[model samples]
Target: MKKDRITTINKTAETIETDLLVYFAVEAKGKMPECDTAVHSQVKKAFELKDFSGKAAEQILFYPPARSKIAAARVLVLGTGPVNKEKDKGAALDMLREVGGEVAKVCASVKARDVVVCLPPPKHLSPALTDPEISAGALAEGIILGDYRFEKYKESTRKKTDYPGLDEIKFVCKDNLKIVHQGVEKAKNAAFAACTARDMANEPGNHWTSADFAAYAKQLAADTGLGYRCLEKKEMEQMGMGGILAVNQGSYVPARMVVLEYLPENRTETILLVGKGLTFDSGGISIKPSAGMEEMKYDMCGGAAVMCAMQAVALEKPDVGVVAIVPATDNMSGSRALHPGDIISHYNGVTSEVVNTDAEGRLILADALAWGIEHFKPACVLDAATLTGAVIIGLGHHYTGLVSNNNALAKAVEAAGSLAGEPVWRLPLNKNYEKQIESDVADIKNTGGKPAGTITAAAYLSKFVGKTPWAHLDIAGTAWEFTKKAYIPKGPSGTATRTFINLVRNWKPGKIK
Candidate 1:
C-alpha cells in the first residue's frame, strides 16, 4: 500500500510547527472560524478593511506576525460562503471539500511540504458541517483528491511542477482525538480508492487491458485477504457468457471476468457490484469518428471504481458481505469484431440483438450482472458504467444518470452519493422505457434507437438483474470532465468510487426500507 499523505494530530494550531497554517472562514457577518486569538484579530482586521470576504472558494494568504504566538510561517484563510443554510447539507459539505482542494493547490504553489489545517468549531456552521467527523473526512478527501496527478508515463523532466509534493498534513480538530482519527482514516481510505480508479482510468488503452484488470484485482486480493478469482476467455466460453465473449471478439487480448469477495464474519447481508470494463472502445466494426476517440481509454472507469472500492471495503472491514465483478474487454474494429445485427446470449440465456456496436458496454455488463446475481444471491445489486453518450446529452456531465428497479434501493444510493459528493439523479425505469429495448428478432436489442438512449441502456441491463433490488449508475457524463471543482481534476473524476465505499461502509441489513 502507498504511504498515507494525511493524518490527524491533537495539537492546537498555535503550537503546531508547520510551513502553512490553514483555516476555513464562513460568510456570516462578524462570525469567524475557530482560530488563535492573535490570528483572529488579523483576519478580523482584513474583513474590516474589505481585504477578504468569506464567499465560497475565496482565499487569503498572509504571513503571521513575528510577535504572534502562531508557530506557522504563513497563515491561509479559505472562504466558504454562508454554510448556515439547513436546506442543502450536501452542498455545504462540498464547500469544505472544495476548500481542501484550494489548500492543496496553495501548498503546491508555495512549496509548503508540511501543513496543518484548523477545522472550524461545531457551533459556527450548519448542522451537517458542524459534525467534526464528517467535516474532517470531507477535507481530507479534498486534499488528496485535488492533489492527485496522473503523470505515471511522463518523463520526470517534463512532469507538471504544480503537483503537490506534500510530505504530511496534520488536522487540528477540537473533537475527541479518537473520533477525529476515525474520520481521517475513513477519508483516507475513500480518497485512496478514488485515486486508484483515476490511475486505472488514466492508463492508455494498450497499457491497461483485460489482463491488467485481472492482474490488479488478483494482487489486491492477495494483499488485502479478500477472495479473488478471474474467469478467462475459455472459462467464459464454457459458461456460455456469450455477451462478454461477443464484445471481446475483436480484441487480441482475451476477456476476463474478475471477481473479488469480502465475506466478513457474521455477515448480515450481501451486495453484488458489477462494473463494465471496456479497456477501450473503438465502436467495433461500426466505428466511431476519430475526432475524440482517444478518450475511449476511459470506457472502463466503471470497472476501476468497483475494483478500487473493494480496496476500501477490505481495509475498513465492513461487516456486510460484498461481491464485486468486472467483465473486462476492449472493443476494437478488428476483422473479427462484432457487427451490427449480431445476436448474442447472456449468462442467463437472455438473447440480445446488437443494433449498434457502439453500445457494447451493456453487452459485457449484462453477463456479469446475471452471473453475480445467480451465484451470490445478494440482497441488492448495484452497477456503474460509462455506458452511454446519451447520458452526457441528458445530464450534461454534472449528474450521474441513475436508473433503478426498486425505489428503496434507489433512495439509499442517492443519499450515499450525496454524502460522497458524487451526486446521482434517479431516472425512471418502467415498462415504458423497457418497451423501447424490445426486439422482434431477439429477447431485447442493445440499442433503443436515439431517443431516451441512457434509459434504454439501463432498460437493457434491467433484464439481467431479475427481481433483486438493483440500481444502475450511468456515469457516462460524470466519470470524466465532471463539473469544475477544485478537488475534481480534469480527467477521470473517480466519481462513483467514493459513493460505493460510503454505501458499503454504512450498509444495514434490510436497508431497503
Candidate 2:
C-alpha cells in the first residue's frame, strides 16, 4: 500500500480505475463547498437525497458520463457525523478509519487494484475544531486505521474467490501534505509491525512454544542486525532465575530468556523493555477453566509487542539504545508442575510464595525485571505484560492500566500512548497495595487479595525493579479484541508496541515537567 499526498482536488485529476475514496464533509445542512460540490452532488442525486442529515456509514457511488475523460468508475462518500453534534473526537477519528476499512473490504471483494483517497478539504472541517494540526492528526489516524487488513491466512482463499486486493492508496491533501504523509507512513509502518506480532501471538500454543518463540526472536534480530541472545534453562539456573525455572517445571519445553539489544551508533540513554512470554498458559497445577482457555494463546502478546517494537526501532534506527528482555515459558499442568504453596526464589534473591499457580505472568516478569536491573542498569525500564484479569475487570478492553513509580516517566509514557493511538490510564500504586504482597513465608506472595489485584500485581513487579525508574503496563484486556472497534481490528490488538517505541524515542532524562 503506497500513500501519496496532493495539494488540491482536481475533478480532472488522472487516476486509476479503482481509486474510490471521494472525501467530503457536511459543515452545514444542504451546504457544500466548491471543491467538494461535484462529488457531493453526485452522491446526493444518486440516492435521490436532498441532504445527509441523519445518515451514518451511507455509501453513494458515482458513474462518469459515457464519453467523459475521468478515469474513476465510482466514488465513496464517508460519513463524518453531523457538524453540530458535539462529536466525540475519538469516535469521529475511529469512524474515519471504519470508512477506510469498509471500503478496502469492498474493493477486496470486487478485485479492485488500487485506491485514490480525496481527503476532506480543510474548509469543510467544523469551525469549532478546524485547526489544521488537529485535522491532519485525525486524517493520518484515519488513513492508517482504515488501511489495516488481517488477511495473511486468507490470501489463498481470497485469490480463489477472485477478491480484489488493494495494492496502493493515494492521499489527496491540499495543505500540510508532507506532514500528513509522514504521519501516515510512520503509522503504517508501526501498524504493519504490530500486525505481524499480533498474528504470531494469536497462533496456537502447539505452533508457538517457548523454544520456537526464542527462535523467532533470534530471526528478527538476525534479519534486522540487532543483538540477540537466548538463555536456556541451564543458563538461567546458573544465573539463579528460580521464578522462571519453577514455572517451567511442568512443561516439556524448557524456559528461555531471550534478550535483544539495539544500540545506535550515537547511543546516549538506555531504555529496557521486559515482556511476559508465556507461550501457552494452562495455569500450571491451578489450571484455568476450559471455557475460554483457547484465549490463552494471547498470553504472549506482551512479549510479541516488545519483539515487534524492537524490530520497528531497528528499522527506524533512532539514536537511543533499547534492550528487549522476554522470559519465554509455558505454564502447564502435570505431575511435576509446581503446586500452590510453593516458594520460589527470584533473580533478585527475593522469595515468592505461589499462592495461586495461575498468577504466573509476574513470576516470569520478576526474573526478567531483576535481570534487566542488574545487567542493563537502564535509566528507565518499562515492562509490559498480560499480567492480571483484574485490569480487565477495571478497564475492560478500552485502555491498558499503567502504574509507575516516577510521575515524569509515567507522563512521558502517556504521551507516547497518545502518539501511538494506544492510550493508557494511570492507576494508583499506593503503598497500601504493596503490603498485600507481603508474605508470611516469603518476601512476597505471588497473588495479593482480590481487591486491587491489578495494583498489587504492579507492586509485586515493583519489588524487582530496584531503584531504576520503572513503569508497569498490564495489557491483559487490551492485548486481544474479539470485536472491531475504532482503528483496532478484532484479534490481538498489539496494544503497546508503538507506544513503547514512541516513549523511548522521545524520552529525556531529568527532564520531567
Candidate 3:
C-alpha cells in the first residue's frame, strides 16, 4: 500500500509552486466566492461562459499562462454545491471529504506528483464549517482515501495506470498552523488505517487466510504497543466454542481468534468490537451459486475493519479502552462440511441449529461476541459483519443497517458513523423478530426466513449479549461497491474502519447508560 505524504503549510495557494493547485468553492448568487484576485477574472469568465456550474462535485480545469500569479502550472476547481446555514458540522465535514476526494482523483488522472489544496475559507463556508481544525481533518481524510490503489499482485508490465501516484499533498491554510497540523495528523492516522483495511480486503483468498489475519494483528500489536493474543483450534475447542469449530470442520486451514486490546491509563469505559472473519464463504453444504463466488473473499471485511481500526486507536491513544476480537476461518463445502439440522453450542452455551451453511458469518461472530463479553466485561459492545443480504434489500449500499439493544449506544454509534461519512440507519428490534429464529430442536437457529432477515440475525446475536449495551451493524451492502463516491473505490469500501475510530475517539463515559 503506497500512501501520499500529507502536510500543511501556512501559506497562500498562489505562492505554492507545485504540479497542480486545487481549490474548492461553493456557488452563491452565480458569483465565485472569495479567491485570489490574480485568477479572479479567469474564473469569472468560465462562470459567464457556463463552462463551470459550480454544482456539487462539478469540476473544471485549465492551465495558467506563463507569469500567472499562481505558481502552479495548472489549476483545478471543484464545486461543493450551495452552502446551507442550517446544516450541522457533520454535513460540512462530509462535503469537505467529498471535495478532497475529488482533488485526489484529478491529481491522479493528470499524474500530478506534487499537489497543493486550498482549504475553503470559513467565511464562505456553511455555518457548520467554522471550525478550521475539523474541516482540515475531513479534507485530509478525503485525499488519503481517494488516493488508494491495490495493485500488489499485478505484474509490473501488465499493470494498468502505472503512473506514480500523488507523492505529496500539501494543505494551504493562512492561519492557525498548529490547529491545522493537528487536524492533518488525525486524518493521516484514521485514513491510513482505512486504507490498510482496503488492502486486506482486496487480497485473494488464496493469498490471505485466517492465519494471515492473526499474523497481521500480532505485528500491529508489537508495533503499536497494544496487548495481543490469539486462540488457535486447540484453545477454541478446549473452551467449547462449537460455533467456530463447526464452521471450520471442512477447511484444512485451522481457525483462529485474534484479540487486540488498547488500555489507556485514563480509560473511562471499555468498548468491545467483534468482527466476523470468514476469510472465504463457500456456503459449506448449502453452497451458493457460482455467480460472483469470487467476491466471497471479501466476507472478512468486517474483521479487517475492526483489526485495522485498532491501529488508529493505538495511534490516537484515545482516553477509552478498546478490545477487538476477530474470529477468523474459511467456510468451505468440503466432504466434512457442516450439515443442515446440526446443532452447535456457542461459547455462551446457547445452541444454534444450522439450517443454512451460507449463514455462517453469524456463527463465528456468536462465539466471539459471547466470549469477548464474558472475558472483557465491556461497558458496551459493537459488532460489524457482512451478515445478511436482507440488509441490502432494506437499505441498499448507501447505509449500514444498525440494530441495538440500547438507545444511547445506538445513537453514539450513529453519530460516529455520520461524522465518519458512513451513515447508519437503525431498524426496529422487536420481540416479534426473535420468533423468527426460534428452533424446535435447539435454543435457536442460525437464520430466520428471508423475511426481515437482517433484523432476525441481530436478534440472534442479541441473545448472546445479555444486558450489555450492544449494537450490531449489518455492513453487507456498504462493505463493497458502496454508493459511488469519489473516495470509495469499486471494491471493498473499508466501511467501518473510520466509524470505529471515531466511536472511540469521541467516546464519553457518561453517554452510554
Candidate 4:
C-alpha cells in the first residue's frame, strides 16, 4: 500500500493549491447545509437544474476552466445525507465513516493526487460531536481509512496511481484548530497501525511464520523503545506451557511465545492484551477438508492485530501500563503432531483434552493468558481470536462475539466497538455452558461439540484468566471474507484492532476505567 500525506490546515478550498478540491455538503429535511458562496452558487445552480441531488454519498466533479477563479483544476462535492436526524450517536458516527470512505473512492476514480476536504458546516453535524474539533476528527479518520489498499505481492504487475500515494490531504476546518490537528494525527496513527495489521494478515503463510512475528515485534520494540522478548521451545518447556507446545508438535518449526511491554511514565495499572498466533492452521492430525484451506493464512489475525496495536500504543505513549503476549506457531499434521484425545497441561496448570486439533486457537491463548496474569498481574485481560465458525452462525457477518466475566468490562468493550464502527454482541457465560467443556479424564475438554461452540470456547479460555476482569472477542466473522464494504477490502478486516486501541487509549487501568 502507498503511504499518503495527511494534513489538517486552517485554509479554504479556493485557497489551497491541488489537483482536486473537495467540499462536503450536508443535506437534512431536503435542505443543503450552508456552503462557501463561491462553490454554493454553482451547487445551487446544479440543484435547480435537477442534475445533482445532495444525497448521502452523492458527488459531482466540475472542471472550472482557468477563468473560474478556483486554484484547483477540478472541484468535487460530496453529500453526507441527513446524518443529523439519526437518534443514536453510534449510528451517526458509522454513517460518517461510510461517507468518508465514499469520498476516498471518488478521488481514486478521478485520479486526484493532491486533494483537499472541507469539514461539514456546523449546522448539519450530529449533536454527538457538536464540538467542531471532534466532528473534524471523525471526518479525518474516514478519509485516511478510505485510502487503505493491499496489493504488495502484485505491486510489480499492478498499474500505478497518479501519485505513489496521496500527494496531500489538506483538511479545512474553521474551529478548534489545535484539537482538529490532534484528532487528525491520532486517526492517521491508528489507521496506519490498522493497515499494518492488514498487511500482516494478507501475506501468505510461508512468508509470515512464528519467526516473522518475532522479528516484527522485536523491530517494533527497538524502534519504539518498548521491551520485547521471544521465549523459544526450550524456554516454553521449562516454563511448562504445554498447550502452546502440544499444538506445535506437528510443525517443522519450533513454537515461540512473544511478549512486548510498554511502561508509561504516569503511575500505573497493568493491562494485558493476549492474542492467538496460529500462522497457518491445517487442522493438524485431524486435518481439514481440501477446499478453501488456502484461507488458513489468516489464522494469525488476532496476533497481527495485537502486534500492530502495540506499535500504535508505543507511538501514542498512553498513560497506563500495557503488555502484549502472542503464542506463535503453525498447526499441521506431522509424525509428532498432537492427536485428538491427547492431554496437555496449560501454563496455569489446567490440563485439557484436545478433542479437535483445529480448536488450537484457544489452546495457545490459554497459555498466553495464564502466563500474562502470572507475570504482569494486569487489572484487566482482553484477548481476541478467529476461534470458531459458530460465531458467524450466531452473529453472522456484522458483529464480534463478546464474552466477559465482568459487566463493566463488557460494557466498555461494547462501547469501544460502537465508536470504532466495529460492533459486537454479548454472549451468555452462564455456568450451564461451562459443563460442556468438562472432561471425564482431564480437568477440561477443548471441544464442546457444535452447541454453544463460541461460548464454550470463551469458557475454556476463561479458566486461565484467573480472577482478573477479562473479556474474549471471537472475531471469526469480521476477520475476513464476509463481504466487501466501500472502505474495507474483502480480505483481512483487521477487525478488533481499533476497538483494542480505543480501550487502551480511553482506559483507566483500574476498574476498567
User: TM-scores, in order shown?
Assistant: 0.96, 0.88, 0.96, 0.96
lDDT of candidates 1 onward, in order: 0.87, 0.75, 0.88, 0.83
The lDDT leader among the candidates is 3
Candidate ranking under TM-score, highest first, comes to 3, 4, 1, 2
Models sorted by lDDT, best on top: 3, 1, 4, 2
Tens digit of per-residue lDDT, candidate 2, span 331-403 = 9987789999999999989999999999999999999999888898788889999999998899988788999
Q: Pairing residues by index, what is the TM-score of model 4?
A: 0.96
> Which scores greater on lDDT, model 2 or model 3?
3
Those runs of model 1 whose alpha carbons end farther than 4 Å from true positions after fitting are: 1-5, 30-35, 65-68, 156-164
**Can you give the lDDT of residue 26 in candidate 1?**
73
Question: Which lDDT tens digits does candidate 1 get at residues 1-513?
Answer: 244657787777787778999987777765554444546776687787887768776778988778877889988887767756665667767876888899888988888888898877766567766667887788888888877887677676674554536788889876677877888899899998999999999999999998999999999999999999999988899999999899889889999999999987799899899998999999998899999999999999999999999999999897899999999999987888888998998899999999999899999999999999999989999999999999899889899999998998998898889888899998887899889999999999998889999999999998998899999999999999999999999989999999999899778888763
Q: Judging by TM-score, tell me the better candidate of 1 and 3.
A: 3
- Among all windows of 10 consecutive residues in model 1, the one with the lowest summed lDDT is 30-39
| Model 2 CA deviation exceeding 4 Å by range | 1-14, 27-38, 43-48, 51-56, 82-99, 105-111, 122-159, 162-165, 174-177, 482-486
Task: Note the residue pairs that clash in candidate 3.
Answer: none
Output the TM-score of candidate 3: 0.96
- Taking all chains together, the TM-score of candidate 2 against the true structure is 0.88
